[model samples]
Target: MHVLTKVKQPFNFFTESVIDLDAVNFWLQKINPLWSSNKALGKIVQKDIAADDMVSVMIQINRNFKFGQAGQHHPVFVAVNGIRYERTYSLTRLNAQHVLLTVKKVNAGIVSTWFSEQAEVGQLVEFGLPYGEMTVPKTASPLVLLAAGSGITPMLSLIKEMSKTQQLKEQPVKLMYWVKNKSDAAFLARFENIASHYANFSFHVFYTQALPADARVNASHAALVTDLANSIVYACGPSGFTAAAEEHFAAAQNVQTEAFSMSALVNDDIGFVNVTLLQTNKVVSIPKGVPILAALEQQNIKPKHGCRMGICNKCACNKAEGATKNLVNGAQNTERGNLLKLCVSSAQTDLVIDL
Candidate 1:
């Protein structure tokens, strides 16, 4: 007979199960390697710094990797100190034998720490296939690109593609770049040169922290829209910056944004419950303080995760039966079960999940 006990709050499901922990870990190790490509080992040929804390690393691929849409990203797997980790970076430029990636190293991050200090020339690194939904539209309409800090990486890629393909011949391209200072602007020289070379391309740099005596603040959203009226706006930056930009273009349907943080997806108020992997008959009881994904990991059940904050959609799984509370909008999905992001979801009820 199936058990129907109503579980109380705060319990460890891993301790209750009699499954072989070693076998489960071995299977997870085997399954984890399948999600990334091991054949695409590449060597780092060159590394250049465009500004303070902003760097561009060029990798020489052994084979011609498939090209992607202008603003797509790829995950690279690297080994450091005998531990493997994955990090995603946007491609700054595409070439037959080389891929350019710009990265802003964050403090104490595993991948960033390696890239900043330990990575050397001629080292082999595995890269996943190019993936992302934010692509430049194939249209001749006017375009407005807004970016702040390292968020300029993808927009720079799109701009370079447009210039190389001559797609800007008929349409005007305007870019608004927000930076802390001139010292923190990545690819500022390249962008300036591009603006000088292309008549259709125009750019404005907004320095927020410090500026020269002659410099002016270009923070007005009204000025941005007035200059590029009717153009599609694509923005990327910190969550607050992107949100402000979105509010500015609230009436415009063509405005699309990408943020570094999904603050909307972090819910602290949800009281946690339990999740049962139906196929494996494995269960993980989550606490109110921890995410469902974290609880599962303690049981050696590692779901595929990219941006654990719900931006990359890598941790999506079918909710076979059970309810989940969304961290972003505080919406609860109980009926019409669909794909749920395990990273940002907390167990609202006893759940049966496919994963």
Candidate 2:
């Protein structure tokens, strides 16, 4: 294998002078599916149903896959019907060569449905670099984790890392997870084991559909732990749940959050701007002050996207021309040749972007 790699390196460099590297990779893949020169590829090693519609996949990655912080999300690329699609999911590292990806099947999610029902062991998948800021903090402050539905994915990753490092034993850690039903929760057994081993670590699962009905994240939820003003909180879930977490922990020392699904933007702007897709040579009139990704999708023009909250750069494209506004920070970009994350950017004027 070493000799073949040494020979292939110079051979590929020589062939790229005349042929595209992708073509070289296409031929090389016939010998070994993981033999990509640039792309990070992984093979599915195991699969299971974690929750009602959530699929858990253990992927054995190649050397090209760069391990990331525990709470980061990685962009996964898969093809369906010869059309490639990309989506981001939070990944939990099991070892240097393996990562766990848990995905929930959305009603009409194409890639998600494939993973849930069609993906098979030994199937190859492509991955991009990881991106996120919800990693565990270095502070020794009391830690609180709030998760809802699929938001538990990242929290699980974070908790695993903390347990490995014995952080769960060193400080007070509380995890409060919310799900529609008891069966909607994942990793209940693992949480129980952790709590049993570490008196400092505790977890609670809130079933919203219970007969008595459990309240969502609110001021009463704050009573789950003492020292609310000094605890560092990490919350992930749908938009409404994370928003409520922020409100509930407003008095906390710090609150970090990421929402898997975004809520509808409620901007007051009422105008349309023409967005030109240079690659497709098509034009779309999108509403001003609305996210470019959402606007384009409304016109049935779907571009690649992941973590629609702007943390993952999967939907980012080159802005050949025109100005755009950052929906998150209200910053404006008028410079040509700037890369913009479409999920969090709005067209401020007529724009040309590579799609």
Candidate 3:
């Protein structure tokens, strides 16, 4: 009898899934279960007076918040009675799990009030990831760090990191900290400790407002340049202060600068000029000397900005159509068909911008 052999059908494997390695890895990392735990959840630790008007709020974050490379800022979000506010502060301490931020309380800032008056230990706040492109280079060249007022925060981080890692031998690092007074100096003890410990590191504290009684030698840009001539210089401060410093270091080839506000663009009389927002088709007259960003802000329209001095590329907008005059250098630089920095450029004519 011929056995009815069941013809074994070959397995088709039609429903098998093929994974794209890159996509699989991306989703695995982005949507991983651990991601939820890594979100910024802040725990108020302690408060200490870093200076007369400046205070340090210690925050303990969960899930190992990524530490910045010496000189970077993290935006802290605070909520009080359901009102949320955010402000960016530079990390004063480097390579530490707990983040320390020093803030000078503004007269009427919401978050500043909460930090100065309401914040308590163990209270939970929110903090964004570390951001800012101002970072220390991994070079062995001589380094010059300059800062004013609270701008010294990031420079402190860089000095501390260099001291901790014994990296001073690789480069001669000098700090030129400019403050209004002795009491306005933030992280003085830490800076003194670094200066004392590292022979390669030098500290020069300049008091622009008033010199301290205990100050042996007053600090000046000329003094710093005399010591570390032709060295790579990094500076941060208010726009006016940075502008003055920048002028001093203009001859130095290796000078880099970061400013808190673009106040330099706000001159005496930046007369009004008409600007047309290309995307919105709205024509707004902006004062010539006043920054275009400020004009937008006055109209209740907030434009993205960082340094405001044409240094940081934050307030860059497409000049889809029209001409502009840059008053800073008295140069009639036009951008009829490209991106322009609204912080520095004023509308020369009825201008169109991709707002």
Candidate 4:
């Protein structure tokens, strides 16, 4: 029994140097793209053009994929023209084995354009673990969800998750979706079907470009809520709309907002700072007020990144020295040997980074 137990102990393949995992994975992927020793892969099973500029893809995720709460985003890695680009997209789980990903084509967006024009049904893609703090709260407070344009993707997921429990009938849930026109709306029929079944759940579509234009979310809309102060509000949209929602809902019990894009901050510092990349031994002068990821990309140094909004930690790197300012909150940090998120941090001084 002791001899058998000794043989059952885990083998240290790296220290023993007995096998090349990369080489093995290469051949395994050739046989089956989803077959891997340890990787989260998914295959696109269906594709639908939800709108002229929006595409909905149904992906079949593998066993290695780690599932999370409904309102989180997952980093999807795809190779276009032999260059890997990573982007984070909100996902709606269809079942234990399938998920739906919606992509909206933005101006000069490579991945979104590819999905809108060239993505096929059988293509394979890699997915990182889902990450985000915006999710359905456990408390039974009345819920108010505000979504604009593509921001409706996560709201759809959160609503579906709520529908699975008895809470959908017990709690008051309302969704206010804003779009330029009714044609641009993605899941109008689905929301309608859900509202028909549950008396406590309802949704309203606001068209901003119609003959009788519906104004964006404002105090007038807040008056529609029965009890605004006690409701838990979740808002997702463009930066301007998200900022407005946060300001308008300040009196709510809880308010969570996620902006899809953020405008670059105009820094007060006019000079430049030298940033040293330890891995490549390359030094570049970057604008003092610009985020490190953007500054590095301007110098033709592309580091792996997902969700330029700083939600995903894919752009985080080790900072050996120097100070950084948080662009999101205007906080300054001079701590050494710390991890810095390049998407949300600007160099405050000359710095060394392990990239």
Candidate 5:
């Protein structure tokens, strides 16, 4: 039976309060790495190295694991040198027994660096509820997936889901993947195989810094370019790539995007923005196009934060008075009395906010 379908464990007030749960869990691991309580989330089952400094971690999800949409991401908690850190990664369901999470190492990124270089197969990790809007729809409508670099992770999931349904053979789906070079395009073989198997599913790989020199955001197959307006385009990538694709396809009928990092709001009035903290009664001059958290941190005002990519809402606060723009997706929110995430939000004007 599925773990979620099983009856909930009865709470033991005395055991929970009197016993050291941490000590008990530690002992359970001594017997066998996977011998922990059902309440204990999960452990890393295997780790596979990939091209372009990436690692695919297979996890044995515990009874408490809640399934998420195919293209959603979930926060993962891991301890490195005794300190816990949280980061978000897209979940790829391989089977009920295990799942895959592929992480690309960011230069000097703590979590990614740890996983790529040091993390072991049997190390424990915990997952939070998954959430994202980049999921594939039930019906296929000539899908156009534009992915750059690591952004292909979710797109891969969606493509595989379609392949399982044998829709790729009949549906008109085009994938334009941009990478710095061939090495960075980690899943080239898998994509090529899928495209070869399905005549309707065409795959194009562009190397931005390599030969076949015309790689760009506007670069798509001749067939896909003509139908851009009618087909639904889901683009995911770095801030620059996603922003460029969004602008290039601005007139498209339906364009949905998800940026892994923050993009800046492009406007003529780029200048220093004066921000007043309502709670602390402190004022700071922040650059117009930088994350509010980074600007504030430079001025010695540190707000609590986890998963600085705007996934975790730990740094979210009230806008209170002024407008701000998200570095990711390049969207602006001017409404007062709204919650804004500081890690991805940049000041659009001199403003007051509840820090």
Candidate 6:
């Protein structure tokens, strides 16, 4: 057996002077484009149109680019004018040296708007380690992927990956996608092509904002998910869409959901509740059904968080007293010293939490 030795990096005052890891890494990266390390780097090549307000960007990765599973999110960092912003997007691997990132611009989303209108080719960007659990399951049973709006990005990744295997062709794979209109439904042509090639795979696109004269199929969830008893389901979308789909698939034993939006339409009366933060010893009055993270942030208190969707437990805090409600499944809990994810948890009553 032969072993290769690794070279050690020499410390330098030029790029190593900063104490902040991110700051030092940023300076080092900008100073030397050839400074190869374990960090991954990608340069923008082109932005192709996927829909009216959606774009599929091609990025060329460095030699150290880490490979992630299909449906995993890529933490993207870019500088707009003079300020830097970080956002996450579903990334699809095109080849060993290329990847694709899809983004759908929101009404006022800063980073997404930049990707649509301001982002230029040949621009370098930083990507963190991928994170997500809403991937294709490892079972041979039927699979149901539920996606809404830009949530279809990850589903596209799963489609691209599963197409190479015989498992998808042998079993039933279906996609339930919802969009505002036909123009916002990205990748419809590709999905139609895939369905044409594979008999076991199929998809349905639901438009909420418009009904065209000619339609492929009605956007009906009940009609699409007729066999949910023996299938693994994955869903990603806005909070309202995921919440509804969650209720629709509540009986399934294997259901995974991801929602990033902090906004939701309150059907029931949330009213007001008192929240007591033990660390800061501050009391605030807010609605009952909103996430505690948003309530605190409204009062100008910042909390540590990642993904903001309850997948990463970065915002988990202990509750010493009082009841809480999970905004995702609408589950209620009242236990002492219970670890609750603040990003997805809302106060049910007068509460005392160790934030």
Q: Cα lDDT of all candidates, in order?
A: 0.72, 0.88, 0.69, 0.87, 0.79, 0.80
Cα lDDT tens digits, model 5, 215-274, are 588644433566776777888887778878888876666887877875444656478989
Looking at model 3, the pairs that clash are: 270-288, 270-289, 271-288
Give the range of the ten consecutive residues with the poorest summed lDDT in model 1: 29-38
Compare the candidates by TM-score and give the number of the best one.
4
Q: Put down candidate 2 lDDT per residue, 196-270, tens digits, no spaces.
A: 999998999999998888988899999867899999999988777877788879899999888777655566667
Q: Give the residue spans of candidate 6 off by over 4 A.
A: 1-38, 212-220, 223-226, 251-253, 267-289
True-structure lDDT of candidate 1: 0.72
**RMSD (CA, Å), each prediction:** 12.8, 5.2, 9.0, 4.1, 4.7, 4.1
Candidate 4 to truth, TM = 0.84
What lDDT does candidate 4 reach at residue 262? 63
lDDT tens readout by residue for model 6, 209-241: 774533322234645566778878888888777
Query: What lDDT tens digits, residue by residue, belong to model 4 across residues 257-349?
Result: 887876455568768999999999999999988789999999999998889877888899999999999776567989999999998788999
lDDT of 1 by residue, 1-355 (tens): 9989977433225423536655543453365422222255567888777678777788877542556688887777889899888777778656877888777877777777677777777676777778776677776768888888878999999998888888867678888888877788787777888888888888877887774532222345536556455678888876666767776765553877776644444546555567778778887777643457767888788888876646677888888887777654445888646988887676777888888
Ten residues in sequence with the least summed lDDT for candidate 5: 6-15
In the range 1-355, model 3's lDDT, one tens digit per residue, is: 8888665433212112323544433443464422222346667688988887788888776663666677877766678889766566787662345878777776676776677778888787666667666677766777888788778888888877777788975678878887777788888777777777778888877776783333222234646465455677788877666667666766564767666554445445545767777667788777666567778989888778754556546789888776665644434656567778887776665667888
TM-score of each: 0.77, 0.81, 0.76, 0.84, 0.82, 0.82
Give the clashing pairs for model 5. 262-327, 263-327, 263-328
lDDT of 6 at 301: 81
The positional error of residue 119 in candidate 5, measured at the CA in angstroms, is 1.2
> lDDT: which is higher, 2 or 3?
2
Which residue segments of model 2 deviate by more than 4 Å? 1-19, 264-284, 288-290, 297-306, 313-341, 344-355
1 versus 6: better TM-score goes to: 6
**Candidate 3 ranges beyond 4 A from true positions:** 1-38, 93-96, 211-220, 226-229, 264-266, 300-315, 321-333, 341-349
Measured on C-alpha atoms, candidate 4 has an lDDT of: 0.87
Q: What is the lDDT of residue 291 in candidate 4?
A: 81
Clashes of each: 1, 0, 3, 0, 3, 0
Model 2 — TM-score against the truth?
0.81
